[model samples]
Target: MPDASPTLGEAGAASVSPTAVLTIYIPSEAPQDKVTRAIDAILAAHPWEVPVIEVSETRLVMCG
Candidate 1:
């Protein structure tokens, strides 16, 4: 499975930026319903207006 943690990188600023690109990986063994629910939960928790959700067979990328 791919790491679900946020990938930390510098954004060429003097201070460390909080802006992050989160990528969630859902395994093949995981059910589609569960994955959907998880994604929903994450979105609800964050509640970002312009969040980007890119879904593929193996991964989901949520960027704000």
Candidate 2:
């Protein structure tokens, strides 16, 4: 069957504000470990504490 889910590129088009809960959908095949490691490295190298990163595979629906 054809994929029915929206792609990361499409989902990212939505506005993301600090006051709002923004959900980012990344590819399942992506190397999450590497991404987290990179993020950790950046945080360690910098002085700012990065926001909490919650990872999960769940379906999301948006109604207008």
Candidate 3:
């Protein structure tokens, strides 16, 4: 018989605290309003603390 257990990434994983920091990455092509609405909906469901959002287009580039 196999050991029936849920992995860390499974649904049994611990839930995140509302005050925990959230990091979201929006694709360049995604609509800002739509993304904002989706984020708002998530926040509304969990009621998290005000997040530190950083929006940048060039942050992922290498300057070497």
Mind giving the per-residue lDDT tens digits that candidate 2 earns over 1-64? 1332332223325433434344566666779797788657655764323355577887668999
lDDT of 1 at 58: 55
Model 2 TM-score, 2 decimals? 0.33
For model 1, residues 1-64, the per-residue Cα lDDT tens digits are 1322333433333334365688877788899799889988877866444357788775557999
**Winning candidate number (TM-score):** 1
- After the best TM-score superposition of candidate 1, give how far the Cα of residue 28 lies from its true spot, in angstroms: 1.6
lDDT of 3: 0.59
TM per candidate comes to 0.50, 0.33, 0.40
What is the lDDT of every predicted structure here?
0.64, 0.54, 0.59
Best by lDDT: 1
Candidate 1: list runs displaced more than 4 Å. Answer: 1-18, 58-64
Determine which window of 10 residues in candidate 2 has minimal summed lDDT. 1-10
- What candidate 3 gets wrong by more than 4 Å, as runs, is 1-18, 48-58
The CA lDDT at 25 in model 3 is 74
